[model samples]
Target: MAHDHQHNHLVQMLDLDAEVLEDFHRELVGWAGSLVGDRPRVVDLGAGTGTGTLALARHLPGAQLTAVDVDDEMLEHLRHRAADAGLQDRIRTVRADLDGDWPALGPADLVWASASMHHLADPARTLARIRDTLRPGGAFMITELDGFPRFLPDPGLEDRCAAEMDRLRREGGMHMHENWGARLTAAGFDLAGERTFELEIPAPLPPAARRYAQVTFARMRERLADRLSADDLAALDDAAATAAHRDDLTVRATRMVWVGRRPS
Candidate 1:
């Protein structure tokens, strides 16, 4: 959650380019503007490091943005990011767990969750909550990984990942949800859409990129260490080391953007 090299680099390696993310927010703003007719309030859930938050602040002028995340350190970095971007006044950072009561945030015109929905214990319920937070006809958007796209080219690695994650979930007593599209529909979104991007990261990963991966893997292990068996932990470490050895590591993480309007 902190702006360690690994965290930031993994984002750069796996997530879309800032320009692409900016373009997306612009498109979403236009869509929301068509309904609300002007700059509208938006809430960015789990706005770690405030990259998206900064982008939204720049793109959505005259907009009130609340960047909500539970991590204080992440929020601290986000605050500086906002200040550096000269958006200190426009973006508000709130520390709260999404599983609990949301902060008195807003009748937001748009609620955007990027790569954060998967972390929610109940994604459908989270969608429903996001829907409730919106004004009438306001939009709730979720961006998630599409699954291992490049895994198809690699031999058994994709399957191995899928199996490992599944095993990890089962061993941890965690119910990991894969189908966000169906979940959104179940949460009362009629007009739903999804998109996939290859996100071809270059080989011999950039130092920042590699750091991101390492930090993320370490973070994940920290979260699961208590739940995982010793063998499981060792297996995960082995897999990570093996993954790091390859010349070209193509991670096929798709960004699924699902926007649903609350029924007016």
Candidate 2:
């Protein structure tokens, strides 16, 4: 029951992210569409909630997509979303732990990994595998976040929260701040392009943004329950409780994307 609740919250958060940041998502999808050929075969690594899978399918009508993830629940949700979007014909879900032996997913035109590579045990090994999985001259795109977004107007509390989160992630062995471009080059991929997106949605955000703030605060509170001071914990509770109605909230985040290609 606890797992189900967590999964539901994650699903809602991902869906809200796409909705609240529609401009960025649309631009990213369009850029991806421009990189592939007609009827291209694409693979989405760690396709949570089918955000990228469905978007790529809609943007490239002729493309076939394989959405791969370890979690059965997430894959099931992706499949349902694909069907609902009338993209089931072009999209298929594969269940596999990316850190383990990967299943046969190869000879593809494009492979996309967004905010997912950091969770892998060995990203260099995974990058090499991805290179082998793609056809010669195929493209591999990786997108990673610097950290979680901040919605509060005052930077002090959010900064403290981010610092704590970073420490916890580091202790947990998450590669939250790796230089992926260097890793790709070292793993034998030809670095094709790199871009950083700095996004900021000012005060009086949409309803979805408010909910996003609430969910993010709640998740942070839960994760840092033990690490944070008592005062911080109380402040977090207040933030989560009031996030939905805050008028001064602003959404700020940074995402970096690196595109590499397998040498022909």
Candidate 3:
């Protein structure tokens, strides 16, 4: 289960000017090139709003995708996106929980998990299933945030927000750091490679990117409302208000990616 409304907002925020999504797919496909065959299938595990699905549609052209997620609204959004892009024939939505019984999807050439592994009830077990469902030599790529957003113009304020978010995560029993490669190895995957992407934009990002960053800060402000001190809260207000301004605005973020393959 997920906070549907919040998840949608989160998607809108991180999808920086749409370039961020392209960066993700570019890196993923770059790591494992067009592995297309007769009806190539790519599983978008825990696919939220089909961000990764749509990316694959463009880069991996001519491949079928199964977008699996428990959130129906998110899947609906994905469906519409696929339809708009004239990719509905190649993309199918499945409402299923990553923790529950696996859906009826057949083996895939590559499985893409973007910021969705943490939500699983049992990530390790689910990973093994992912491995088993992949064809020989299939690849699995997963991405997770190194930490919360650090794109504020002010580093000091961003640190304060990050520290508070870390505390909240701890209190909520959320798992933050997991050795994804090690888990994949245990799940019978041959470690392939991994990398960390630094998404940084200079001040005065495009109008869309600026609005994206502002939305991100607004969501963060809402989440830290009760926890931030009076001074910190005021600083956040200033940050949120100026997030969309072109003058002296900067954005920085890190996304960790782990790639593995099922043995041939």
Candidate 4:
């Protein structure tokens, strides 16, 4: 039950990300579509909530997408979202752990991994596997976040929270900061393109953004319960409680994307 509850929060968070950052998502999907053929066979690694899968499907009507994730619950949620979007025909969900033996997902023309590669136990090996999964000259796109988005107007509290989160992630062995472009080259993929997006949505945020801020604060509060100082935890609690009602909130985030290609 606890796991399910956590998954629910994750689902809401991912979906809200797509919703609140609709422009960025659309631009990303368009850019990804530009790298492939009209009838490209795409694979979305760690496809949580089917955001990329469904977006790619809708953007490229002729594309076929396979959304793969280790969590059965995530896959189930993706399937349901695809069905709701009327993209079930073009999108299929596969449950497989990328850290272990990968299932046959290839000869794909394009493989997309968004904010998911950093979680792999061995990213280099996974990159090699992804190279093999794609056909010659096929493209692989990777997206990674610097950290969670910050919604506070004053940067002090959020900065402290981010530092604590970084410490926690580092101690927990997460690869949050990696030179992925160089890694792709070392993995024998030609670095095709790299871009970093800096997003800032100002005050008068939509209702969805407000809820997103609330959820993010709440999650941070829970995760940093023991890590943050007493005063910081209390501030987080107050922020989470009043986030939805705050008019001064702004969303700031940075995302980096790297594209690599299998040499023909």
After superposition, candidate 1 runs with Cα above 4 Å error: 1-37, 146-162, 169-176, 202-207, 210-247
- Stretches > 4 Å off in candidate 4: none
Task: Rank the models by lDDT, top first.
Answer: 4, 2, 3, 1
TM-score of 2: 0.97
Please identify which of the two predictions, 1 or 4, would achieve the higher TM-score against the true structure: 4
Candidate 2: residue pairs that collide: none
Cα shift from native, residue 97, model 1 (Å): 1.3
Top candidate when judged by lDDT against the true structure: 4
- Candidate 2, residues 131-213, lDDT tens digits: the string is 99999999998989988799987798888889998999888888988999999999999999999999999999888899999
Candidate no. 4 TM-score = 0.97
Judged by whole-model lDDT over C-alpha atoms, candidate 4 comes out at 0.91
State residue 135's C-alpha deviation in candidate 4, in Å: 0.2
| TM-score, cand. 1 | 0.71
Which digits, one per residue and each the tens of the lDDT, describe model 4 over residues 139-210? 999999999899988899899989998999888778898999999999999999999999989997889999
Clashing pairs in 4: none
Residue-level lDDT tens digits of model 1 in 1-264: 444654654444333334333445566545544444357788989887776677777766778889999888778888987898889998899999998877787688888887677666766677878877888878776766533234123455345445565677656554344676677678886554565544555566654444444444454455456666676567556545655555565433445566677778
Q: What tens digits encode model 3's per-residue C-alpha lDDT throughout 33-71?
A: 544464568998988777788888767776889999998
